[model samples]
Target: MTDPLAGRVLRGDRRAVARAITRVENGDDSTDLLNGIGKSLGRAFILGLTGPPGTGKSTLVDRIIAQYRGRKMKVGVIAVDPTSPITGGALLGDRVRMAQHTLDSGVFIRSMASRGWSGGLSGAVSEAIQILDAAGMEVVMIETVGIGQSDIEIMKIAHAVMVVTMPGLGDDVQVSKAGLMEIGDIYAVNKSDLPGADAMVVNLLSMVRDMKGRSPPVLKVSALKGEGVDRLFDAVEAIRGRFLSPAGEEMRLRSVRGMIVELAKKKLLSEFEGRAFARSVEVARKVADHKMSYEEAAERLVDG
Candidate 1:
């Protein structure tokens, strides 16, 4: 069959952009499209925003997009929401906050369902980002499904990962449990106007100080009222500048290499499971039941 999504991706068509993202999210021929979209994708900066559920990640992303748009930047957003296991549906409520941008030609927003992926992202997210990059987006932001801890997968693909948190969410135990200290390249204390905001910053700073190596800059902002957003933007630009340099590029390349290796390992294991290994498993099961010694079974399989 002809690849309609690939055609649209290469042509930079917006509707085609949406369609390609849908195909990726649904795991429909995404590998072919991604292969075509690679190398062309390095042009866009991939920003990953992740955090606890109430941290205002979607609002902060919306504000950042608006700021980028003001500077004539083309923005692509991938908002990942959890899928209902029973219904396989996602609310996609983040898109509603960005409705104003719908009228702006420069902004493209696509929502993805996590489909029960354990790492707080949909399987299609990486390919979707490539499609946006190929479509000429200068910046692509991925908003992960906010599932407290175990959201570290975004760190693998994002050039910079932002961990967002709010005031009074929990104790120091909560912060540690969330895995916030290790994953964030930038820490955003969103909703700074709320009570206990300073305490939150202090706790984060204390944690960073203790960590002592490559600690991300922590900034406080109120996404709802736009307080401290300019500072947040400045910090983001500075972080981007530092990380996109030669050294930063090296780190990015290393990350990409690691991802490829992991993908290969996964694919190889899958292939082995479906082929020669299937018969091996049955033989191994018999060996386990004492039908034959393990060594004898292994020798037989190897000889066969």
Candidate 2:
């Protein structure tokens, strides 16, 4: 029998969307669910926002929503917030600034707990984006769980990524240290009302100039004050167009190839563990004891 939930999701039913996301958060990998949403994916433009904690990424997301809504397009948001270790859940305050649209039928919002990912986002976010795209959202925005330099996996999920920064953080030198400069397609220097804002902008521009290829634009926006948001939205639209063009197909293919490798690795690990968990643990202990190399141990597991 066809799953009614899948039908509801494709029709853009909010409750069904919420229910489906809940399954994803709980680590559901049911074949039926994936098959249901498979063909309908990749229609919406995905915008990913990532930066250090306390940079007000959520506020910027709200601003993006308003811009898309102004054009009468349906919008979907996935706010990935840190999960509470004690409760394994999140307060989900990411939507507080967006409370005004709680009743809007054109907007759909879902908050997912990062589930102990200090820098790694919950693996379920990509699936969530696919659901929203299949549901016909014109634009889907993913606000990452506040991340630092080591977490760059968000790039694989979004067609265009916005790295939001602000004044009074460390020097622009921190951008490369944080590994952000290489991944950002667009940059927003939020909290532009604060001191050092212009310096921040110029620093970002100088950094971009040093890069080899396409220099991404960095705009200043006071996300708190809703200043310069229009310029940011326009940049996103322009970048979105570029992502859909033939020139950008290589980038898209690269992203897909990476995702495929990740999935295959996960599948291999699962099968390896099912048959050889005890053996793998023994090899791990040997490696830790400096008696065996990890490369040899990996070969053992794969060859076994």
Candidate 3:
């Protein structure tokens, strides 16, 4: 709990912060570093942006970073990219697109390989977010890999989830689907300069009309042209303000609780995979031979 690296990270040293995140990504046991900064966590807001491929999510993130930095806020970005088969690393580093902020020092951007995580986010993203939060980043944004229906897992970790989409490419219908529509706190129709942008916005608005509680707002944004980005920033800030309010305390606490549960589950699953994998073949043979029931084999595995 008294790690020098953690102290440096807490002091907002960008290099130390980067090193901490790298340790997490490389699967090094970072329990001490995390504990060192545990008390300083939960102050930063976690914003998640997810959408299908070709939605220009990277460009939108670039614009959003400028919005936060203009207010003198320290911002952190985690861009989860697809895994590279050859190198087992992030295939498309989004840092390339946000090159303008390379020397800002106030902005820290990291690209992580999804590493075959099924949910479009890197497995180490939560740890990386905690590192950034401890580093005094007022806003930590997570841009997930291009996602589909099952990739809405970002909802569990993010304080606010923005689902970005564009006109054409059947995005209007895609957003209306069950999983995507339910997870979005806000929807941004990117590439509003395109032909079908207005209709896309209308379709989303109509879909969210009967969505029990606060309906997610649909915004028309052209990330490439900087159109409607200011308004988008205003909307994002509004959500941030709400999350920081007294009434939203339970929501924030719930997110923290969920994160803890997820971490515990991951730890248990890692152990189970390591132990149970070796017994799998034998267990399957016993079950196939009717020497042991499936339930019994499962119980045996768990007990071992």
Query: Model 3 Cα displacement at 292 (Å)?
Result: 4.2
On TM-score, the stronger of 1 and 2 is: 2
Q: On lDDT, who's better, 2 or 3?
A: 3
Give each model's clash number: 0, 0, 0
> How does each model score on TM-score?
0.81, 0.83, 0.87
Of the two candidates 1 and 3, the one with more favorable TM-score, higher being better, is 3
Candidate 1 Cα outliers beyond 4 Å, as residue runs: 1-4, 83-102, 118-123, 146-150, 258-262, 265-273, 280-304
Give the worst 10-residue stretch by lDDT in candidate 2: 83-92
Candidate 3 colliding pairs: none
Writing each residue's lDDT as its tens digit, candidate 2 over 1-304 gives 4567788899988888888877766656544675787777666777888777667787787778777878888999887656422111222244543453566678887777765543224346666776787788988887764354224675666788898889988957566677788888898899899999899989989988898986999999987788999999889999778777888776666655644554455456556677887778889999999999989988988788
Model 3 per-residue lDDT tens digits across residues 85-169: 1111222234443453456788888878765654313336778898999999999988864355324654578888898999985
- Candidate 3 — which residues are off by over 4 angstroms? 83-102, 118-123, 146-150, 278-285, 288-296
Clashing pairs in 1: none
By TM-score rank, best first, the candidates go: 3, 2, 1
- The collision pairs in model 2 are none
Could you tell me how far off, in angstroms, the CA of residue 45 lies in candidate 3 after the best superposition?
0.9
